[model samples]
Target: MDYDSVRTVDTAVADALIGERERQEETLAMIASENHVSEAVLEAQGSVLTNKYAEGYPGERYYAGCAYADEIEQLAIDRATELWGAEHVNVQPHSGTQANQAVYHAMLDPGDKILSLELTHGGHLSHGHPANFTGQMYTVEQYEVDPETGRIDYDGLAELAESFGPDIIVSGYSAYPRAVDWERIQAAADAVDAYHLADIAHITGLVAAGVHPSPVGIADFVTGSTHKTIRAGRGGIVMCDAEYADEIDQAVFPGGQGGPLMHNVAGKAVGFKEALTPEFEAYAQAVVDNAETLGETLVDHGLSLVSGGTDTHLVLVDLRDSHPDLSGGDAEDALTEAGIILNGNTVPGETRSPFDPSGIRAGTAGLTTRGFDGAAMEEVGDLIYRVVDNHDDEAVIEEVGERVLELCADHPLYAE
Candidate 1:
């Protein structure tokens, strides 16, 4: 990953780029929203397509000189269609947030009612957090998980829908660990004569690989980030039935953004092609297996896992019971110093601020991409528990750092 040309032009930027590559190579990436893209995807994202700007969809661009752009964009749309089995696909949203924004713009009015999960309870900002545009524009009514079980309370959601009478219901989450029952959410939306937008931003790859149930056929609209679990370059996608295809396309292009990132479209094409293979299916399953192992290991060490365990690639650990004095921020800092990376997240019933929450969320997607297995994840879990348990101990941190380095050596991220 040497940036020879970049070094010749600007040494400082090149050095930072190389430094980032080295950082990824040496450390663990357990952030549930992150993943390691394949070299092919990297190359595609860095290709000459970045020089072009296609203002519209394929064969109907508002600008000339978009032949290759059309080709890449169409390939991405086709591959996404095949993977999700959606009748229509739009691969032009710059990120998942934008993908979601497009859905709102296409189907919602400024003050329309939106019923979604609460942010602290596993919802995303785009779902309707006040800080985001979605919250400011829409009248949002939030639902919560069953505090005791740490899972979505579908019965409560139906009741909430009846009372709120929302125009649309948003499902999918950022930190939740269990598989969602799309049918249940869809039924709620149906009873209220509302639309359903399922944002699978965190589980795009799992859905693509069939490791998780897909919402393409059930939800009125489905959106996701291409990079998180999909290993595609950074981008977003929207899918729906053919009836709403034109409205979605117009909303994404003219309403939300202009000039799609063609290079990222190419990357999505390549990554989606890679995901279609049998090996990718096995990899997705392994990711879930690793998370299960990590969660069980943490439980064995007497830590509290929200929802008891995970059915996906992440486990949310509430630290209040196990390490009352240590904040999630403290654990994050200690783990990063020890070469193991993850995020401090808010649990379902968070008692602290989001900045220094009471929970840590660890994921297995990046590790599985780098060839990590259940046993490796178990060891990683132990390392995390040690660091979180002894966050202030420099000696413990150094020892854990050494073991993490050894683990990184065993599983190299990108081949030379």
Candidate 2:
């Protein structure tokens, strides 16, 4: 991951790059939304294709020198189709947020009703959080998980859809822990005459590996990021039935973006190809198993998990019961000091600000990418709990920090 070529002209940037690589090499990346991509995907993302300006779909670009662009984009689409079985796939959207934007442009008008999960309730900002454009431009209503179960309240969502008369309903989530019932949500949308848009941005690889149920055939529109669980560098994709293909394409290009990042598309192609391997399935399964182990470890140490456990790659820990005086932000800072990287999150029925909420969210995707197994994750879970439980103890922080470095070194990333 050294930048020797860039170091020739830009020593400053090269220093920052080297520092970031060393940081990743030394710490635990427990952030749910982040993952390490393969060197092949990295190479493709930095390929010469970045200089191209492919403004449209394959073989139909506005530019003349796009034959290579067409070839790479089609391969991305083909591999993605084989992975998720979406009748139509558009890899042009710049991110998962932009992918959602394309769906809205294609299927919704300004001021259309959008019924989605609340931001503090495991939903993403693009799903109608007030700070996002979706909230300002659209009529937005939100649903929440059951306080008792910490799982999506399907009946409540259905009733809300019926009452709100939404034009669209969004499913999938960013911080949720349990497996989703996409069919039930689709039925709710159907009952309300609303389109179902499943944003599987965080679980794309799990779905592709069949570790999680897919929303491709059930939802009216399906969108995801390329890097979360799939390790496809960084990009977004929109998929739908053939009938909505052209609408999605147009929405993505003239509607939401101009020139496609051809290099990112190449990265997506390479990563999708990697995901198709049989070994990827084992990797995906290990991710879930590791999460389960981590969750159990926390619970065993008297930390409370939001969903009681996890069926996905991440877990949300509601710290109020075990450490009422400690804020999630404090816990986050303490863990960071201990070389564990994660984020403060708002739990359901949050009584704290988003900045210093009542919960911490962590994931095993990055650790699993570094080849962490059940035992390794259990130790990680122990270290995380120790840091959170004794957040103020400098001695504990120092000890955990050393252990984290040892773990990182044991499971070396990007080893030459």
What TM-scores do the predictions have? 0.99, 0.99
Pairs in steric clash, model 2: none
Residue-by-residue lDDT tens digits, candidate 2, 1-416: 67999999999999999999999999999999999999899899999998999887898889999999999999999999999999999998889999999999999999999999999999999999889999988999999999999999999999999899999999999989999999999999999899999999999999999999999899999999999999996989999999998899989989988999999999999999999999899999999999999999999999999979999999999999999999999999999999999999999999999999999999999999999999999999999988988899999999999999999989999967
Lowest lDDT block of 10, candidate 1: 322-331
- The TM-score obtained by model 2 is 0.99
**Whole-model lDDT for model 1 versus the true structure?**
0.94
Q: In model 2, which runs have C-alpha deviations exceeding 4 angstroms? A: none
Candidate 1 lDDT, 267-299, residue by residue in tens: 999999999899999999999999999999999
